[model samples]
Target chain A: MNHPWTGPRLARVALLLAVAVFGPAAGPRSGFETMSPELRAMQQDDLANPGMLHVAEGEAQFQQQGCTACHSAEAMQGVAARYPAFDAARDGPIDLAGRIAQCREERQGRAPLPREGKEMLALSVFVAHQSRGLPLTPNPDPRMEFVRRQGEALFRERRGQLNLSCGQCHDDNAGRRLAGSLIPEGHANGYPLYRLEWQGLGSLQRRLRNCMVGVRSEPFAPGAAEYIALEAFLAERARGLVVETPAVRP
Target chain B: MARTLLRVPGTAQRGEVVEIRTLIQHPMETGFRPGADGTVQPRDIIRRFTCLYNNRPVFEADLHPAIAANPYLTFTFVARESGVLAFIWEGDNGFSQTETRALTVA
Candidate 1:
């Protein structure tokens, strides 16, 4: 008679058991928590935070575009927390940036803002700023399930010359040193943030693309479905983490 | 137009020291860096910042490319009287911005 349990299967079972017994090793930690005190102080101080400059620019752009005609900035509160939402027109998930572009094209009868452009970054940053301190609340639509699943698969799938997946570093080796910097859990709670490396405000997609480049992988185009899906999954993963739009990071 | 943020106390007691903070949006691109096209980027930075209270110079700074983008500065001055505080920043590429705030001393 053959034994049913193989060595690999037994190891997998043991790992699962350990996970179940101990729960996750740590609770979700924001990149903000991992930042140096100086950077943290920069993020906390509106006068010092460079991201506030983008927020100011965005506010002016919103008013110039007559966004106030439809709704006030206060009305946008909590909006950013529920992004990567299902779009009926696209029949897919759309991130906050995409929604803004769509509204510009359809609602305003104007050309959509260019991805990663100064205007777009400013607008998105401004919109996201309104949701600061609010917990991320990803859309719960059943339609989003498929997108979220795709995002999860892409996140775990190994690719690139480095032969590493996002989860391999962010999930399995978080808090470990990579080069001179600590590997963060890769949450998307604070986005359209100011990065000292970039010396400017950048969107979450830009950050993801940078990671792909670091791994020597071909990055998807801006506004790609893969990115939107990934953003949806990240929004879900980052649920309960407060939005820290325009956050400062080294 | 470049954006600037100014933080000056709206009110202070006479002879009390008050802090004034300012932040300006600028790339402050050092000439040493190469662009995406493999071309050397020209140096651009805020070269000077001046603060005047009641038309009298109170503080001044000469910035350089070594300074980071979005330059921020904070300084304190004794409150003397109700007056306007003017901030002026001059930089490369003919960049210049002026902002003013009113302060009241009781």
Candidate 2:
């Protein structure tokens, strides 16, 4: 019998078990599918979804910041689906928020917004909202391959006091109960989502940090390269999943 | 400044019941919570929400600390005549916001 206590061995076993049960290629499913009917209803109703408030705030910011001077709302459609794109200036992959921050600094000649601040969240939500209902389309630039691989490694690497990889719960035990909450497949299609736990809209990075903390691991600093890499990987992993920016999560 | 969202039917038949939904962004900090510095954060919450139809009060609610951040309220009012509907929220820290929407009734 294979020992299941070793980190890599356990992770491999978990993956094999997942593949055995789910088949070689399981269809991408959204976290929305796992939510209760009430939450699903909440997410569907624009009037009731609190995340729309951020979208409104973002709209105001977009106009006030002269974003309309270069990009109209129509021009922004499907932009979010192609995130974590290669940034030649940074010589690295940059997520949508990072790209926005860079634009504010380079093009708008303004200070970058704080990563987790309200202004940033509003802008991200607003930009992402443009891509709502579109599929996540990862950047096809060959340079992104390295970062995507790094993200996959991070997803499968076991760490923290619990010695758990993200795939262990999100991939292997998806749909299973954990502390009374169903484990989702950890797709990034609906990001800058409004989580009831946070009582506010937050970026995928915030959720990732929360998970890291859950496993007793030190989270990467906000806007870190690692987070961007992971985002790139998640984008590819969640390919074809429709964007649900500002989605409500219970 | 807090962002607010208001939804109302653009037109309705006279005597028809119409639903009005409003959502506003606010922390609604319950004074009982401690801040990062470990001191009790002073309470800040939207204490009241009032809706006026044609300059007359139609709905009013007294919000408390228990209300979640980003308060959302949905209520109904009878359509009578074409007029402006006003929403006003009052809260601690001298917070207040007023928004108006026009409803056409046939």
Candidate 3:
């Protein structure tokens, strides 16, 4: 229901406004060339000065609980902009939670948390806030087009023994709830989202797989082509929705 | 009221880890609290469960009050062991429900 602005001229105008606001007045490292030294430092101060009420919990868990050894707030900044990315290394796309869990498994020398759990939710929410107000950006890898098309087809297609496609419930009934929980519009944007019921967080794939079960259909494999296509379709739909990974949702 | 699922982890190795999750529609009332008045509500809930792999017991568990209503349970097995995962839920008043899913490990 939110009208968004998109166009080259608008973007150009905004860029000029940004330059004027930051240039000369802010002095030294004002332009994009001298970016990090002063610009980043200023933004970081503004970003860190006032934090979300919920982020405190995750920060506590990360720093005091030793999660900082693996990830830091600064490192996660703008990270949500590039999620649901095609990882040729794994030969597929992985959601933010999966990436977090991957590091927890291989690099941090720790056990991975369950796909959706409070631990992951708090962490994901905390991490996503770092990229607040950033633009939604998804990779437009050429090789992924095939999968993206498939997912889009599936979204609009009805399936399952129950004869329901994801779009029927999600797009048609965006603001309704199923049992007791309020249903989100169900955008894949900001996934690896934090859900209150699970008291946890997980990737978009995990939620999609669960929906398949609810609809009496077999879920695709964890990293299957079916899911990648689905991811592509969702990301395209969520374009310009802003990056709010780790956003809190009931 | 019995719900059954065929949980094949993947297609490659019938020896791969496969899980079948089942949930039954039961109030699963853990009778202890009073009913309408101060009268004690009789406990009537699913008391026992057994899962059979091709007609043999491969998994089993006892139910308690701590379990949520309409219980869901998942059983995992090594793949290539093609069989049927049948679930049986029985309660205090002889209330029972049964369902099954045909599974191919390979």
Candidate 4:
């Protein structure tokens, strides 16, 4: 029998290790992969996962608000993938939360929901859940070009007392350790995820707020244009990645 | 409003053991933590969780602040016949939620 780790095999193993260490680092992997085994198991098991609770509540609200009277739940599928979509009526881009708020005000004749509130988070989770496994593809209309540009600027611009840009931590130094936590690639594929830090489900805006606070910068309001733009920017960066809404994160 | 998720096998063979899992949404806040005002928040957590199968007690747990938010619990029971499993969780400030799942045996 031939020895597997001698001569040519030894050289191949050395080359593989070198590439693994010096590779481009960025990948389409979900932040869920960085979680502990117990946390991963909780997310894999729907019955044991808390995020599903929010999904359930969101489903209930969708019906209670009479949304089902016109739009079938099935029709809502793939709808979230197109979010942060350009709204000609508003003459600007809007995310899933923004679009839902619009429907509440114009169609349902109801007041807009408070941003990041339980109802809003639940509704977002419920809608995003339907798009699970579908690749995200933000709208690319001409009107949205400026907004995406602003989003890109916001992501790369340095701000706050710490003077750190999002790209520095999430894009350049991802997979590295910081404050005992692994800095993920900061993808928005998993919004409204159940975070151990929050001990509950939260929206992408909520996570952005946390980052803002971390950098010691004043957080933008829930529906602020800045957050909306940043969300769009993140969505564009995560394009082609499968939606992982209601995910569990440590 | 509280949301609950329950997992139970759709069918099981007689005399076989089956797994049951459940999770519920709750803050499970520990009073030791300070609030936005920097004041110590009062402890609030789920106090008890109980499961009944066929109207008979199957499992029970006394939870504390140490339990994570959205308390989760799992257990197994032998399959004897078709029946309903009831889960009840009671906590601080009169918080309570109940859910039921069906089990069938062949």
For this target, which candidate reaches the highest DockQ against the unseen true structure? 4
The residue ranges of model 1 lying beyond 4 angstroms of the native Cα positions read A1-26
Ranking of models by lDDT: 2, 1, 4, 3
Candidate 3 chain B, which ten residues in sequence have the lowest lDDT sum?
A: B1-10
Check candidate 1 and list the clashing pairs. Answer: none
- Candidate 2: docking tier: medium
Model 4: per-residue Cα lDDT over B4-94, one tens digit each: 7777788899999988888888889987899999999988899999999898988999998778998888899898988988899999999
lDDT of 3 by residue, A82-147 (tens): 566677777877666666677677777788786556566556667766776566666678766666
Model 1 DockQ class: medium
* Per-residue C-alpha lDDT of model 4 across residues A116-210, encoded as one tens digit per residue: 88888888899888877677888877777788889999999997999999999998898899989999888888787999888888888888889
Candidate closer to the true structure by TM-score (higher is better), 3 or 4: 4
What would the DockQ be for model 3? Answer: 0.01
TM-scores for all candidates?
0.91, 0.90, 0.47, 0.89
Which parts of model 4 have CA positions greater than 4 angstroms off?
A: A1-22, A25-27
Better structure of 1 and 4 per DockQ: 4
Highest-scoring model, lDDT: 2
lDDT of 2 by residue, A36-143 (tens): 999987887777889989889899989998889899988888999999899999888888888888889998899878878988889899999988877788999999
> Model 1, residue B98: displacement in angstroms?
1.2
